[model samples]
Target: MKRRHFLQLTGATLAAVSLVQTARAAQPPATDAKAFRAMRKYANLSFGRIAYVDRGTGDAALFLHGAPLNSFQWRGAIDLLSPYRRCIAPDFMGLGYSEVPEHQALDARAQLEMLVALLDSLGIRAVDIVASDSGGAVAQLFVAHYPKRVRTLLLTNCDVEPNSPPPGIKPILDMARAGTLADMTAEWLTDRAKARATFGAAVFVNPAQLTDEIIDYYVQPLVSSPLRRSQYERYHLALTPNPLAGIESRLAHSTVPVRIVWGGSDTLFPQTDAAYLDRIFPRSQGVHVIPEAKLFFQEEYPSVIAAEARRVWGMR
Candidate 1:
């Protein structure tokens, strides 16, 4: 069957499951809402009323998600990181439950501004940043512009330079500009099998772990009309001049320690880019390559990634 048809069928299947649940209970469970509330209280910041989850209390550790995802991406890692430090994960503007401002620039600079506003609102003077994929680009810009706020940097599966994007991503950007993003989202984001395959292609050490529930969770928001457009815009912004275009120059002069964790099997951004990042951030102390993992290392191997975070933070 065509990918679009498959997705439509899958949506029907999910709807059936919801109906079954409703028949069993008069009201839906509040587990997800309650969990979201916990995250919100920990990372409550001002740019918008972002949904987040916070765990533990001590030094701050901020987890940033990539395009099309929210704090939900860190669901597996949050519990593990919370015991060691205050883990703050926020849904960036235009993603998750965060306010999707219609007039917002949606560029790298605008994202950095929101980050700064968020930190200032929360009165968080400093933090250790852990970023993946597009989030890494945002974190790089944050570190470059506000070095004082960052104590350590952890970059994973990200391209630091504007010219270094992986092979096919540029073409996807071109397609988005040509008004093909909606179709692409329908193919890649909404389809359950495709979504599972894409996530597996990126970061599954064990493909068996890509469960139906997980795939449903990832694609659920995209089912909404506005959320899908917000996600598409994020990809469009990434194709332009990155906010961290001159990141090497900034990192070269930065005093904060840096570390890189890469999934050797990452099909999006290859492991070769890790060396380029290490060269740029000379003070980088370690580079770990998780052999079986893919781009989304935290999801595939949260325990390992959490342990690495603790080690990087000197909590281990």
Candidate 2:
């Protein structure tokens, strides 16, 4: 079946399930602020002092953030999952407090190698990876090349196929490739409102959570450092056709258990891509779509995502 048609059917099925559960609905608990604060820390890795926080203990669970943002993106979800498993949220090179490299090697292979080296330096042999946005592509490369190192995989709202990127993304990719960092930032990156809307529109199942404070947290790192724009440009340039093509094919042959969690409201990649991914891994379970959520579903519906991760890891 076509991906769009599959998603439409899935949406209808989920809506029906929601109706059944409506009668028993109850309010979710408030997020724990103290726990969130406690989980915030930094780690020094090989490439640079890539900042990361490791909370709780037992199996290792690495949370890889998307473009523009860093480990801070996983704060809320880390709080929930930390109680049951060791959760590590690392700022990708050039993002967050991580030191930006002098050289321009931010592509998938370089980033994947950095991750592997970081894990080895930390003495961790294997981990369950939860990656979103650009990080999803990084995770795919890591698993494909180092399959035994990845215990499980969770991908959200990221596309590996060059032919299947969402409509407007191609233009942005082209812009990032051709333009200077200053031009890209002035023309696209620094707009606080646009950033909020772009990110909020992509991941949050609840639009109401796109508060000014949340937006500021996301935008702060980008603006705080002068290098942010250049770093982003280098990262974009690193995304070559070769690595992506290889990762796409490897995903089909992967033996590692995989789960796809998406926000139904995501217009960036669209929930339709979920079907394309499902076909690649037929043994993988069906995609789980959080209704009101957008691309950043992990931020908007962390508890739901946390629960799903626990299920995949067999922790609870």
Candidate 3:
């Protein structure tokens, strides 16, 4: 073969191989409930037992999830970030796989206290927090009071200023107030079709991504029994009328560095809320609007969340 022809053929073969490799990498891994099921750990707090996912080792990264959801929301993000950081995701009292006590206060203040207790129990002194929705409100309260313990505060499509629960969540809250939340949630838990119509519509922008495993993870524990259902309602009712009103003063003076990532399409907590959050935190890095995302955007873009956490941690 001529030398030029031989070189061209070799290059073409290499390009073909590269393309094949890239294509393989682009395909997502198989989704399985077992693969994503985190090792459930428990912390015995004064209020109740807090179930959490404690994985990896190194600097701590605490993940706080929104209402009507739990630590499962942070599973994908933990899988990505756990390699370099100790990822801790806990189920707030009255939610998820955690033990729900009828006597405890499940409000933002109580949740914050429980968070401190959990970290203390884990012996985690300092952490970077990644919070979403109502969980963001809890984190805000934490960062303000425990500023020294939090290294970086990352907020995503969360409660801020004027829209604490946001309008989209009002209907759900209304149902909870009306004593119908348990029945509605139980219906969705048992019926995939109902879940598709309700949970899918309310929580996710891309319904196809709301796999059977994800639905089971969210609803099964809450609907497991009557006590759990009652606990769920109690938690919802525990929410204070103005959870963020008091936090505003502290947020304006927070020393911990802040970063905001908004799902550009999240009607529950829109970009306007993100903008308001950015303004309140004196040390905010700024807002990152993911145009194709919504409330559970971290699940859609775990890599982005992990990257930002690492960047803020100075590990990348």
Give the top-scoring candidate (TM-score): 3
Sort by lDDT, best first: what order?
3, 2, 1
Using alpha carbons, what is the TM-score of model 3? 0.88
lDDT of 3 by residue, 26-116 (tens): 3234324565463888888887888998989998999999878888787777877788889999998888888857677888889999999
RMSD to truth, every model = 12.7, 4.5, 10.1
lDDT of each: 0.66, 0.67, 0.77
Q: What is residue 270's positional error in candidate 1, in angstroms?
A: 1.9
**Candidate 3 error regions (>4 Å):** 1-32, 36-38
Q: Which residue runs of candidate 1 sit more than 4 Å off their true CA positions? A: 1-47, 162-164, 186-190, 227-231
TM-score of each: 0.80, 0.80, 0.88
Question: How far off is residue 144 in model 2, in Å?
Answer: 0.2
Give the alpha carbon lDDT tens digit for every residue of 1-316 in model 2.
Answer: 7664466447734643443244114324434434544555655555766667788788889899986667767776676788877888887876655675577467777788888887887789999999987788888788879989999887888765652344545656786777554354442334656644654555565555666655555545554555766676666556545456745677788888777777766677677677667667634545776666666767655666676676567654
What number of clashing residue pairs does each candidate have, in the order they appear?
A: 6, 9, 0
The better candidate by lDDT, 1 or 3, is 3
